[model samples]
Target chain A: MVNVLIDGLKERISNAIKINQSIGIILPASNYPDLVQALFERINSTPEEAWVYVTVTKPCDNILSQFEFLKDSKNIKFVDCISRAAGINKANDNCIFVESPTMLEKIGLEIINIFKEVDENVKKYLVIDSLTNLIIYNDPDIVTEFFYHIINRTRTKNIHTISLAIEEEELDKYLTRLIYLNDKILKVRDSFI
Target chain B: MPITELSKNELCDTGIEELDVMLGGGIPTGSTVLVVGSSGSGKTTLCMQYLINGAKKGERGVFFTITEPLFKLTKNMEGFEFYDKKLIESGMVNLIDLRIISERLGLDTEKYTVEDASALLDILRDIADELNVKRLVIDSITALCYRLQTPEMIRDFIFKLGSSLAAMKCTTLLTSEVPPRKFQYSQYGIEEFISDGIMFLGDIERKGDLIRTFQLVKMRGAAHSRTKSAMSISTKNGVELAPLLKSRE
Candidate 1:
């Protein structure tokens, strides 16, 4: 599987670029901006085309604006994966939903459903805003099983998914297992400024 | 601080030479220490070291595991030089196996009640007392915290557990996986306040090198090393902490 290392702030962003996969940033809640920057810069480093999906739980913040910048960047297509669907309408494009710690299980299943809606013929990559919110909002058993399901679908359907989470004391082993299922894993660590 | 009949000499060693030295020879006898860290940061290994050290000294040790089965637990530590399987078999070090407890509770077994914390606490207390456990380890307070789901409840349970251990006059180590970045304020915030002591293990990368470090954030009535020290886990040594350093590199 995948070998992951929790790296320093500078190294963290670069490591994300090196792996060139969806990354999981495990830090304190306040460090979300640093992690988002790390991901954004990593995405910008590549000359190749990329379709970046920014799905957040809470309302728009600075990271949302950063996504707007990527919209003008060469070879990058951004999609909002959060759904505002009533039941299970997977085909709606503008009907997006936001991710929040309170809605981890709900949004998780929605993201999975969205993946199900995508045409199998197209190559797609999914970046989960974070795995920590999932851990904070849901039990590890549920989150692990949820990630397992996502990994299974990604592999069987050739979809690449990068999930992020802030590292907490006991959840690393579980995170390691989830990363093991992925093609590659990148971990970020930050030095408080 | 007022002196008590219990002295620091009665505490069990952690098997880490530098750490024991830093802890004023060992953890304070009959006190609780919360061990917090990020995922894969060696929280369990620290607990294992504490228990194995106790077992080696002819004192009883108890491990209450929440997530892994006994085989996997044993297998994972099989490579660690200090894992004393003999001690395990001889009952010097006992694993309560919360996985089994949860499984039984799922099957509606009368032995375990998933509905209440009091029942779980009672069962745990019974086990600790029956063994005359000198050192008690709860693999994680997080699993219980996740199920319980309230800071207030967690606060009460943690305080109660700490008090129970103090009453039993047994030293305890409770593991909690707190994101180093987010929960640094208290590791889970209020937990450090409830527990007798707080020990933190962090895996940090510096200048392209991944380093494992540890520190004693707070201890109620004991003299402890204040330095953030280096630590490591390998086949030869399960969890080894170095002498406390002056600063984080």
Candidate 2:
């Protein structure tokens, strides 16, 4: 497993991964760019781990452009849900395109298939780019239910999963329930290195 | 200038006196207003009141329910003083249940095609023409958007629906589910842009108590208060808008 790039947070994050495979992170929307950069840096450091990045907010091309270094990595897989939803049909050999974020079943099935295809020698990780965007397209209860299923399935498969969400003053009841379902909750601060 | 007088013919009363006052009279005639709020925020009650007000004034009204069944809706409204069963029985107030139609048409999909939108538009037009509906309400448009696959489809549906309603000169109110976000105007965020007016209902926590607040975000051509006012509901009066709260800033 690759350690996060943040100074003090690296050890804590690694410890959380050891204690519990599934983790949920809450942070201000403004901090998402920094977090994503740090996350990709960590993923790039680890050669044996294969990652499936499920993006609900941005298109695969946009995400790839930000972390261009990871584009050539064989261990990185992209599940582009935004492109098909936006009516773009561009095909990429390295990415799987889902129709839309509302098609939770399709996304879940794709994740399962990816897990099956990867060899046992490679460690697997699933990163849901965002839960906030998912809730915007679907009902809160429905999104929460989908997360429950995905988290439980990933845990059973021994595949590490990370879900990200924006912090709100009053946490949504459904999202609060989702946080409880996860093994650990990490609050990402804007000042974190 | 003296308080500008509003022509009674140009405004449609919202059934709530205080709300009408806050709206600079009622909403302009033939305008589409988006009523946005979270669950249990009295969105349905406001829609029901709008239709009941029209029925009481001898104007024909139609309510298209996409989320709940007609029977359950009527049963739940039994406690409201304005919910008269006779209005529906007399055909003055028509309830077109779209839930059954949605199920049959398999409306739940990744994307709602143009054909699907046309089919829905046809049904709405037919009912509007047959009933000569002067007032119209879609219990909730949020549920409809969930079935439609893309943001474009949802936007197209709202545009067509608004245009059609305006052609009939029918005052329409569409309810939208407000997401958990504190600042969201509507579910997909496009509803407020397409609507002629937007009304927001939400609760504020003060000393651990939830105080319901109502605000008129904007009204295209009318003069209205922008301040957030306290709100309450009762069986006798469906919705009441109180004085605006002091600005937190």
For A62-154, candidate 1 gives per-residue lDDT tens digits of 344556655445533333323321232343232234323333333434444455555566545666765654555455565666666666655
Candidate 2 C-alpha lDDT tens digits along A1-193: 1233353455555677767889888778877776677677778888789899999988988888788998888888888878977887887767888766765655776777677889987788888888887777665766776788788788888899888887655556656677777888998775454
Q: Give the number of the best model, judged by TM-score.
A: 2
After superposition of all CA atoms, the RMSD between model 1 and the true structure is 19.2
Give per-residue CA lDDT, model 2, range B41-105, as digits (tens): 99999888889888999989999987888888999898998899999999988888886665577
Which residue runs of candidate 1 sit more than 4 Å off their true CA positions?
A: A1-193, B1-8, B105-115, B183-188, B243-249
Candidate with top lDDT is 2
Give the Cα error of residue A44 in candidate 2, in Å: 83
Query: Candidate 2: global Cα-lDDT?
Result: 0.78
Clashing pairs in 2: B110-B149, B111-B149, B112-B149
For candidate 1 chain A, the 10 contiguous residues with the lowest summed lDDT are A1-10
